[model samples]
Target: MATSKSVLFVCLGNICRSPIAEAVFRKQATDKGVANDWRIDSAATSTYEIGNPPDHRGLACMKRHAVPMRHVARQVTQDDFQSYDYMLCMDESNLSDLNKKASKVKNCKAKVELLGSYDPQKVLIIRDPYYGSDQDFETVYEQCVRCCNAFLEANS
Candidate 1:
């Protein structure tokens, strides 16, 4: 059996950007026939939207792109710090928050980084679309596609 590599995508609320990134990466991995080789999931930096479903705009965007997305918002856990191979976050604040959390987790092994770091287009931040228009959600989706593609290629 292939060894498993896990990644956890994180954002402020979990309802907008991170879920989209998780779904996009999953679909890309699946398309490359490596979906089973990796474990993919998403979480939030804050508990504000914990237990809530992804934002409707994000859901619509995923559906439009034919990316299957199903997730409940959850705060990043200490176990995530130790378990995931990578904890990829949306923006600078998320990167800082996750690093702070991971610092407190004994033996944490995950490499926390900005997901946009993988974008070939050099878009270094995936902005939150929570209060933005539907176009903003589409932009998030576009950035995820670029970043996730490069990420998969690098890891493969």
Candidate 2:
């Protein structure tokens, strides 16, 4: 492995889970005073929400919990596989999508991982909050916060 320290969080849409993971990871790193040690980003599996701001609910959820991060939705790019050290997915479907893309990559260096992989004792998938109630968003946010914090602990 390269000594590079960067991570790319991915999900079905950039509107929700991935952005939360990105922000959560960023926040955790900052809290640990290791924010300068890593570069973090997020992307979507599909183009549906590309060029759009993160979903309102996603933002509200973060705001409610006070996990600050703002980003526009974007689709995963070929260049990301080369630029990032790790590519983390929110769930199995997104992981499969990323894998399909990675299979076509030449000299791929990025390690694809599930966001929950950071949570050694409870490897649960981060649930999607797009179609749910505010309470659901809170639940998802809480889970991502925990997983993201764990990621920082293990990696930093």
Candidate 3:
């Protein structure tokens, strides 16, 4: 059996950007026949949206692309710091928040970094679309596809 690799996608509220990233990566990995090698999930940097479903706009966008996504908002935990192989976040604020949280954990082994760091186009941030229109969600989806594809290729 192949060894398992895990990733935790994170964002401000986990209702918008992170879920999109998680779904995109999952789909790409599945397409490449590596889905069984991954343990993918998404989380929030804050408790503001804990237990909430992903934002409706993001859900619609994922459906449009035929990328299956179903997730409840959850905050990053100490266990996550030790568990996931990579903890990829959306923006600078998320990077800072996750690094801060990881520092508080007893022994964090995950490589925490910006998901956009993998984007070939150098679009270094995936902005939240929570308060924006459907167009904003589409932008997030596009960026996620670009970044997630690069990330999967690099890691493969």
Q: Tell me the whole-model lDDT of each prediction, alpha carbons only.
A: 0.94, 0.85, 0.93
lDDT of 3 by residue, 20-139 (tens): 999999999999999999999999999999999999889999999999999999999999999899999999999999988888888898999999999899999998887789999999
Which pairs clash inside model 2?
none
Q: TM-score for all predictions?
A: 0.97, 0.93, 0.97
Lowest lDDT block of 10, candidate 2: 1-10
Cand. 2 Cα-lDDT: 0.85
Put down candidate 1 lDDT per residue, 92-155, tens digits, no spaces: 9999999889889999999999999999999999999888999999999999999999988989
Return the lDDT, model 3, position 108.
Answer: 93
Query: Ten residues in a row with the worst lDDT in model 1?
Result: 1-10
Query: Among all windows of ten consecutive residues in candidate 3, which has the lowest summed lDDT?
Result: 1-10
Provide backbone clash counts, one per model: 0, 0, 0
lDDT of 2 by residue, 126-155 (tens): 888889888877777777877888877777
Model 3 RMSD, rounded to 1 decimal? 1.0
